[model samples]
Target: MPDSDLLLIGLGNPGAKYDFNRHNVGFLIIDELARRWGFSLSAGKWQSQSCRERKWGSRVLMVKPQTFMNRSGQAVAEFAKFYKIPLQHIIVIHDDLDMHPGRLKLVQGGGAGGHNGIRSITQSLGGNDFFRLKIGIGRPGRGEVHPEIPVESYVLSNMGAEEQEILESRFDPIEEGLRTFIESGVAKAMSLINSIK
Candidate 1:
């Protein structure tokens, strides 16, 4: 059993090849958090890699689902069920194509907005009440090599140098905002993250 009821899940397709893809921003955030916290992830029975630590008076379980992007909920559901964690206590971090790169939005209880991972989690958890930290990756445009790349291909592709730098620069703020979330709640976190220019 888990010592804490709070859970944080980062969404991405598992494997080295997809490491820097636009769809893997959540995983990148998880990796950065792990680096900053000095924690390490280990394979878990729920088909996820995770680390646990007490932060801000909460025993937080940070997880990276290994069940791939679409099936992420399978691992998340297993862990949540085993830990007996409530929906409101769970937070998911994922990429969003609707907003420009480097943008972040923290919110609770909403639709998936066409994200398969969020949709899967909502379906498996039987509700959309969980919190979400959205990292914007933006939609592809005609300036790229392909005149019209499909959304799937665009997201699965690795991020360009400029985009990568922009996103990386926001990591510090993201960390601060997440700390706010852990220390307070989604509302405060949203105020901090969403205000980032």
Candidate 2:
């Protein structure tokens, strides 16, 4: 399996303080996936915590960058170079502010959409060909929606109980979608993940 045939990068700031924040949804998803797949975590190369599992005849490496959100690309680029992972085989899971909360969308080769983490990654990688699995946290102060909170504060805020429950509920489908991505390809993964309503 060449050590690691696929790389899954979850974008988030490290530390317990950011654990349940909306911006940390990527970390939450990665943690849940690691638990479900029985992948043990360890301090990994490139400023990240990671785990590797061999399944379906491939080595899947999952990482959560500990370099904080803005500098995530440094860790990602370093890891990818060390593993010799191709750009197309890398998947970055992160939160999105453009879509409604609880929505999931998978896309490849897109602009960062104002995400500093994504921007850093794109710059470090020197390309935008990697896959992105975006879990929507939505923007605040739109109409009557959370108007008191600023966008920065909103994302860093802990999710409301209802929001947390909603995201947890989608974990099953997210798992299935990731499995499909590994088994099939981006096309199938997109069909499965983007269709979630």
Cα-based TM-score, every candidate: 0.92, 0.95
Which regions of candidate 2 are displaced past 4 Å? 1-4
The global Cα lDDT (0 to 1) of model 2 is 0.88
Model 2 lDDT per residue over 1-197, tens place: 23347888998989999999999999999999889888977896888999877865678889999999999999899888988999988999999988878899989989999899999999999999999999988788764458789989999999999889989988998988877888887788899999986
Q: Per-residue lDDT tens digits of candidate 1, residues 1-197?
A: 12446788999999999999999999998998899888899996788899888876778889999999999998888888988899988989999988777788888888889999999999999998998989988777723333388889989999999989998899999889877777776778889999976
Q: Model 1: what TM-score?
A: 0.92
Q: Report the number of the highest-lDDT candidate.
A: 2
Top candidate on TM-score is 2
**Model 1 alpha-carbon miss at residue 105, Å:** 0.3
In model 2, what is the error at residue 120, expressed in angstroms?
0.7
User: Least lDDT summed over 10 consecutive residues: which range in candidate 1?
Assistant: 138-147
Find the number of clashing residue pairs for candidate 1: 0
- Compared with the true structure, all predictions reach lDDT values of 0.87, 0.88
Candidate 1: list runs displaced more than 4 Å: 1-4, 142-147
In model 2, state the lDDT of residue 170: 86
Error of 1 at 55 (Å): 1.5
